[model samples]
Target: MKKNGGIRFLRWLILFAKRFLKDDMPASSAQLTYYLTLALFPFLVFLINLLSYTKLSTWSLTEDLLTVLPAGTMQIITSVIRETIEAKSTTLLSFSALFALFSTSRAMNALNRALNKAYRVQGTRPIWKNAMLSFLFTMGLIVLIVATLSLMVFGQLIGEHLFTLLGASVYFLHIWNLMRYFLPVAIMVLIFSLFYRFMPNTEVRFSNVWRGAVFSTIGWIVASLLFSYYVNRFGSYTRVYGSLGGIIVFLVWLYLSSFILLVGGEINAVLLYGDSKIK
Candidate 1:
């Protein structure tokens, strides 16, 4: 039975690979990278402008972003924010906000198309409806980012205070420390699951999508960590690309992220629709 199970798993993996290549995910990921790169700076500007109206500090957001983004990429982003602040032009801010909204919506729309390809589904939604949904998704994504930053910034203080009142043990404090790491991971899974469930044109059950969501969350974290390690320890993009090195590295990282995200959708597609020939 164990041997049969192993064989079945191997066959499934092979089928997945074949379909992944057939879908030309690498090209699709490149397309996503383009839209994402275009949107990224404007989104940052929009975020900075929006934060000016709130009490939240940009430093918190930067720290959170650094957890996933390379230090070089963070430097670029931080420098942009700094320059934006120095300029302090109300018109630039206003334009950035509008442009950010439109570009981010386009990025989300591109992502929707890619995922549809993964699931082998046609674009059923009308252009206007798709545009509105993408716009809403972009807004929700911004809220999610802010909420995550807020949780990371304030969660510990709240936890400590509550634990003090309860007279929690030292061991409980250690567990809470562990939860600090888990919280971001949990949020990642939730985000992936939500996107997988709703982003595609077809109806996807929660049960069918959970596996892909978990796979994507884990794959993304692992890929980011490995990429970060290699870039920091051995890789020298600056030596090869000079001043544009940071941008190159950032694009590569985004491509990797895009590939993994779509692969997760492919996983779900295979599981839901692939034949049981192996079994």
Candidate 2:
């Protein structure tokens, strides 16, 4: 029975790969990349504006961004943030915040369409309804991002304070340190699970979404690490593209991210609904 189950699992995995390729992942990824390129700076400006009203240190926010972004890309992003802050252009900030919200929703709309295609469902919702949903999802995503950054910036401090208050041993600090790494992973899983559960038009069980979310999150982390390593070691984009290399690299990263997200949606579709529609 175990052997049969293993064989079935392998078959499913193979089918998923085939489906992912056939699903026009490249086109969808390109669309997402375009939208993201338009949205990136605006989104960052919106975030910075929101953070300005809070007690959170902008330095911590930059640090959090640097953790996930490639070094070259992060440098470009940081420079933009610094310039924007130094310029103190409220008009630009306000315009960027509104534009980012709408543009991000537009990107989410594209994602919604991709998810529907993955599930073999035609979009039946009204355009306005879909737009509203996308808008909500965009807002949710921004909140999730800010919350995640806050955790990364302050989680250790909070943990240490709690431990001291509880009179815990020094070993607790070691455990907290370990948890700092896992905390981001856990938050990512939660975000992915929510995306899987709600972004698609069809009903998906929480259990099924969790499975795909975990798989996708691990895949994304692996792919990102590998891509980062390759870029650092062998990439010569700067030599070829001159000053535009960083932008190119950022777009490629966004494309990879989009592909992985759609792949994850496909996995959930296959797992929940089988390969009947995906063939």
Best by lDDT: 1
The number of the candidate with the highest TM-score is 2
The alpha-carbon deviation from the true structure for residue 169 of candidate 1, after best TM-score superposition, in angstroms, is 6.9
Please give the lDDT score at residue 126 for candidate 1: 91
Q: What digit string (tens of lDDT, one per residue) describes model 2 on residues 1-279?
A: 999999999999888877777777778878977887788789888777666767877877778657666656777888877877666566877899888988888788888888888887888988888888888778777776766776678878978897989999999988887887787788778888888888788888789888878887898788877777777778898899989888877788888888888788888888887778865
CA displacement after TM-score superposition, residue 199 of candidate 1 (Å): 2.0
Ten-residue region with minimum lDDT total, candidate 1: 270-279
lDDT of 2 at 108: 86
The local distance difference test score of each candidate is 0.81, 0.80
Error of 1 at 230 (Å): 0.6
Estimate the TM-score for candidate 1: 0.89
> What ranges in model 2 sit over 4 Å off?
1-6, 52-56
TM-score per prediction, in order, is 0.89, 0.90
The pairs that clash in candidate 2 are none
